[model samples]
Target chain A: MTEHPGRITREDVAHVARLARLRLTDDELDLYTGQLGVILDHAADVASLDLDGVAPTAHAMAVTNVLRSDTPRPGLDRDEVLAAAPEVEQHRFRVPRILGEAP
Target chain B: MDRYQGGGVVTEGWELVIGLEVHCELRTETKLFCGCRNLFGDEPNSNVCPVCLGLPGSLPVLNQRAVELAMAIGTALHCDIRPSTFHRKNYFYPDQAKDYQISQYDEPINVDGWLDLPDGFRVRVERAHLEEDTGKTTHAGASGRIHGADYSLVDYNRSGVPLVEIVSAPDMRTAVQARAYATELRAILIASGASDGKMEEGSMRVDANVSVRRSTDATFGTRCEIKNLNSVRSLGRAIDYEAQRQVALLESGGVVEQQTRHWDEGTGRTETLRSKEEAYDYRYFREPDLVPVVPDAEWKAAVADTLGLMPAQRRARLVELLSGGNGAGGNDGDGDGDGELRVDQIATVVDLGLDDLVVGAVAAGVPATLALARTANEAATDAEAARRLDGSSYVALLTLEASGSLSATQAKVVLGDLLLAGGGDPAMLAKEKGFEAMSADSLVETVGQAVAAEPDAWARYCDGEDKLAQVFVGKVMKATRGQANGKAVVAELQRLRG
Candidate 1:
């Protein structure tokens, strides 16, 4: 459990928006800063609960080991799959200069 | 205590600390969370579905065989299998079509395992966790570098493939030890049937974290992670180069920066990729679409049963066979006279995953030394052909050599023919190639003729200049048209001398 340090600043919102490739206006950044602050406050309230012995739950349902066999099934047709992309070249998904590089 | 000096700049007191992270793709038929075929070299975007492509309203289901193979690796590395869950590692990368990768962060499937290298050193495995592979991005530019690339192409055929990343502790002291660890781990992966261990094809990838510190320092220096180390040789070279770079920097009163470096194989140097401040935070959170995986006792035991003998165990078994005692008899007479197999020969057999071939031949009553030499030297040349070879043929070849029906050289030629062209019996091949072993009496007569003809060489041999014995053996081989066994000729010469 963790606590919210303080109000979410406009700079923080701007930084996140840039990382997400979101072209947010100054007004939008200010609005997001306020809205995100409220969400963080609410999250901190939940985190403030004194449930020391309780286990953290990852899913709401009581399911575990939901897996499929390794056998292959019919996949989407290649033409149909590529048709949905914005661009295609040599049967591949073509994109503009991929920002930095791949890891 | 090997000190690395980078760029010919001597930093004699600095010790290099290296740790490796290896990612091996599991040998599953389908994708990790979809039914798309998990294959390589297929047409781009040919093996994709809505789930793998991250289309709207598509959900992911775990692949059971991938988990089982991950557990098999854990068991082989002596890891503790635990209940694990997946998380969404959020980032902005076109390679990951979803802009987020489904991976295991905190609670991985396998934890706290250790692998023992053939050099008698052990490396602690931090975790062996499962994740989905991203797409392949091919940059197009004059330099072919991403920084100056005009555009890029993406192949989703590799996407959604299952991968298990084995992270090792910073327990390696030198580059040689690091390579040995990777080699042994690759053998274990191949032995466990978890991965094909093809680093060149990108099925198995390695990234090395290297740092240099003063020999007397109690704390570690700053480390840089070097990527693009696709081969074992590249991994070693990158670590050595990076360590020297860091050492040279420190010697000039400069601090080592925490960054990710790219290994330029052509230039044999590491260049800065990005600094820590520019690195992605990879905001991780629990993946809501998937459930936890908890393998019960029975499931673990079943996976354990499927695991074959690991490389170390196989090497030990081969050594036992080479020592000739058979674990019960008083000297079965199969040793190489020194009761030890050469380390390189053992590594060759084990690394090629052909130890079982040698073992099977020995089990069929062929001498261990003969089996080891043939497999290590001859069969190992063509690994693909060797894997398809029948154990009976291998044993037949060795048996022929052991019984003196074919000399060692002749046996190698016949074995090479069998491996390359794949037909004809060993004896038949020997006859067709004019490599038939001469009779003992014929060899005796040839040796007698050689002694009479090469009087000066035979007199030198009889005068305790034993080095001249090769002269008589060579002459006998010439007289017999290379059909006489050299060992037999030598034995006949010794008998005549007596």
Candidate 2:
């Protein structure tokens, strides 16, 4: 299979926008796609700069076990918790129809 | 969807492959990268700043405390403390003010770790990484149900909250084990002082990935992920439901699709949220605004110091401390019958946030059993002690019982009074309120009065009618507000009647 060009196109950007749930305008999508390509390309450059034996870094801080004593605390009352939700009923948050119809 | 007829339909055996991604909100006074408060509920948008809101030209400053907490959790989980990196997970959901979430991706802080289960079983932990929380969204006017009427409200109080997401390997085979694993994991987190494990308040959220395969199959089946499961019970139930759904589909000669699903805890089912996507979906890359986080050795040591006693070690210590004559302390030789507090009982006390109080009261000279009772009595009898007599007051009550100043039953009575009235001393209040036991002279006088007043009853007792013994016993006890010892009262009354 022929590898696609290194540059990320508008189509690639549109596909991502759809997945991420962003309703960007065509021009904005175009702009971000190019910008994202450049950013990824720069990251690719960093990925290339390697000392053969260098270790991969995940966390910047060298920290160890941080913990709390195992103790149960009084939780927020149901009403107090429910009061914060914009839509709530019977002590739970309510939302809208999230599922699309199945084929 | 194919409907299976009948309420209790029996199905063939299918093994479930369950994995959990637990996202716990880290306990910190401020946001992960900003000074804004990390509180859950405040006035909407009140805790926002240019830094958290991702305004132009505002650089992200990593919180030292957040990193320490992350590493603390990593160590507690037995994860390899590998060098890690943070990347911007690009996504645009309504809750996030910043389109991209600053999170650890390919290079996670913690590598492979294992959590021990009750029966020597283990849950494999894949990675534990740090990330900033997104703002909250509330659908207004609507039932908050996805399918309904009206607009939604947004709250940013939870935004920028420091969080660590622990992803586990699909090693769990049963829902019960999954629940236990989550509970144990939460217990460890709480013990480490990392998080409160308040699932209901959204501090601890779980996403379960579940699939079903033939019991003997070595290869895995397609999996469906259920998100936003807040409670342990819900996590187990959702996993079971999702796994069963997949099994049913496979049994019906259908395929199990890989998708993101939402759990409807109300109906006890899962629904598809999104389909699987390739790498280009997220388009993750290095965060330009923030520099690499290189936690030095000293910082790692400081973080290690932050870790408290882990749950397993704490449990063993508690068991040893409560164990009698086992060289673990406590006066087990007294034969007072309380050798060590049961694990369940200790767990209960911990649940009530009364661990310190129990220990304090015990140290202050209360017997184990009497502490609760004494606290009750002290609370009922003394106002000041009553104010202090919560679940922990039992410790002091135990002391009183151990000292022989109060009986177990009396301690309970005092505890009840204190729990309700909020102030009173067991001894002084009992005396002032005439709750004290009647003196011998007073009991004798009342018995004599009863004999004189009731000639028939007295004659029956004089005739040695055995039943009259009960009558005399009742009369004396009535005179003493039920505090008189029944046996003593019967004898005194019998002599007076004769």
Best by DockQ: 1
| Count of clashes, each model | 1, 56
Pairs of residues at least 3 apart in sequence or in different chains that clash in candidate 1: B6-B244
**iRMSD per model?**
1.2, 9.9
Per-chain TM-score of candidate 2, chain B: 0.73
The CA root-mean-square deviation of candidate 2, after full C-alpha superposition on the true structure, stands at: 10.8
lDDT for residue B80 in candidate 1, whole number 0-100: 99
Q: Which 10-residue window in model 1 chain B sums to the lowest lDDT?
A: B1-10
Q: How well is candidate 1 docked (DockQ)?
A: 0.64
**Which lDDT tens digits does candidate 2 get at residues B170-203?**
9988877787777778878877778877788889
Model 1: how many Å of interface RMSD?
1.2
TM-score of each model's chain B: 0.80, 0.73
